[model samples]
Target: MPSSELFLIALATVLALPWLIWRLGRTDAWAPLVVVQILTGIALGPGLFGAAFPEIHRTVLNEEVIAMLGGVASWGVILFVWIAGTELDLSQAWRERRDSTVTAGLAMLGPLVLGGVVGMGLLWHAPGWMGPSASSWQFVAAIGMACSVTALPILILFMERLEILRKSLGQRVLRYASLDDLAIWGLLALILVDLERLGKQAAFLGLFFLATVILRRALPRLNPQDRWFLSLVWLALCALAADWAGLHYMVGAFLAGAVLEADWLDQQRLDRLREMLLLVMMPVFFLYTGLRTEWQLGGASVFAAAAALLLAGVGGKLLGLRLAGRILDWPPGQARLIGWLLQTKALIMIIFANILLDRAVISAETFTALLLMAAASTMLTIPMAQRAMKHFQDQSPEPSKLQSQR
Candidate 1:
């Protein structure tokens, strides 16, 4: 390897150490340490100082290194998906179930409808703005699709912050979000397949579903020791296959999670790998995103449009959760907390935005704007959720449902 490459590797390790230390510090910020990694990366990676530190930057944040870092055992997320599927309180959703499923369904629907509607209306009112760029229905569908998503990791962080990991509300959000990801992935998969202009991929898409169904049934046949090893292998193979199939690796990830079948699996190899990811691999991923993402795109109008979309994203979620809380007659405090949490946008939107950007389905200007919108939405939401939960607590001093989460 070149001297520069070795230095970059050394730099990545040096920068990654703080997050590992922080993870051991017993702070919730440990979960959000990706934020920290990026700050450090910007200081180290090429730009101004990076130009001066060109050797350091090349090794650590260069295309090869970033790809490796960003790709850090993303299978950790895959394992999480598996754990998430197994941990689902289908019973809670079922026995107490009103069409809260429908509510969750509409929670997604309203946003999709609103996003597309807003896009069309804006273009209709102004001529030559984006110049027949985004159609009303396409506007509605894509943006709405983006808006309707809730990030799983963000929810996990919110729960960690509020100390609600074991509560019914937390469980509810996790379950609903899991369902949301499923629906969104299914739709996105279809859209992407269509975009690939690959009719054969369509058959393969159906095959992926059928294969997952068959594999879930077949997985149990392996002996105990073999099962653990084989499962990880299954994850790697499926993940790569999804990538090649033009489905971003999330489909494989979701399937990997959905198949785990038990909590015991988390305590095994998956747990160990997840720990490693949280310690080293994951922080690099975030740092990589922050250090690399271009922030300086677009004029005032694009910023305005992006801003408006984000507000709608946040508002749409809070409104949906609040409405559900009311209909369920959930304690006002808990209901309100739910509103905040629903704003915890997830990975789905970010991934979709990239696909749109990559396909030139949206302008680079619009793409950068929306990408920023996703990051901003994620940043602002954690606080929004925490405060909303707090507000509910203050208004209802009677030890309400929200408190049960703690």
Candidate 2:
């Protein structure tokens, strides 16, 4: 009956509008879905209903919401990981091709190093928007690099829509994307462990990694049903451990993908799993990011800092990709695409930025700037990589020719 309580209910009801539209049979508009949901969350958050109807959010911010959101984020990530593992089928993918491997490696490397360097530089001339951050450049750079990197899930969706997943090159790109995701997420975990003290926070991940080593050896031969059950349990354990460590649930979710159910899970099961993620898991985590992001209205230096970081993030990935390709002796196109694909940043990095802000490791404006850079880089990389891939595919020889020669 309370006015604040009624406002909170109204906010939740408004957020339910998109799904209502979807259920009315219009799911093709994903871009609108994302925008509307995010905008709804923002309106409901402290900015509007929570401001005018301040009493509404007070009760809604209870422990239950946090716990539920935490669980959903955890499960969403696990489902994503499960799907990633399923995509590793290499029938079409050719790892023997020096060009593809070289391309993927370089592409993955470029933004990581570049972002790190730029993040470090911000320490020297503390931007007014960022205020004073307690964290060092190395830390900032690590988070920046992580944010600048791509999401395998989103990229895979693009590939599927293009009918590229059925192609040899597409399969290979997924392989490389898989590897890139592994390496970047791993780096993120290590950085987070260091941030929270490796001794305390790294223990579960280390254990999980070791378990992965064991599973990697056994999964190919395990009974299908057993593999499925064991993998789910492993996923659960990782989630619980991360929650216990006061780390983001995705740490466990990502590791679950990188390590468990890899060889055993197939398309059908993965599809079902993805349904759970899409329907129940990811929305809360992502929409919350949009809502909770603290926007500083007038911060020129923050804008400059954001721009600098974006350039560094993109440029670093490109640089790393080229260097990695050169060292590894990969072909030019493969190197280029890998670098581009790796530049697609998304939800994970934003999560890290929030953590940093929460811990007082960075200032409000700085955090918002980082998120801006992340969004811009993510938007830019996908189309860029697609174009690059088109050009590369055009230059490559047909498989039928090689088959005939053989």
**Scored by Cα lDDT, where does model 1 land?**
0.57
Stretches > 4 Å off in candidate 1: 1-32, 35-92, 117-140, 195-198, 267-275, 295-302, 346-348, 355-367, 391-406
Q: Write the per-residue lDDT of candidate 2 for residues 1-406, one digit (tens) a residue.
A: 5545544454466447656765575643333243344344444555455667766566665445645555555455556654564444333235454654565556655666666666667666754333343447536655455544666666665556655555655555566666556566666655555454556576766776788788788777878887787777877777678756755565666556655433356646666666566556566655455446554544566678778888877787777767776787666676677666566555545655666665455666666677677666666655677777776763443344211000
Q: List the candidate 2 regions with Cα displacement exceeding 4 Å.
A: 1-70, 81-94, 97-101, 125-134, 194-206, 213-226, 242-249, 296-304, 318-341, 351-364, 381-406
Tens-place lDDT digits, model 1, residues 54-145: 77556555666655555553544555544444443454456545745855775676566666665665466443323133444454466667
The residue pairs found clashing in candidate 1 are 8-59, 8-60, 81-257, 82-257, 112-144, 116-139, 116-140, 150-346, 151-345, 151-346
Worst 10 residues of 1 by lDDT: 397-406
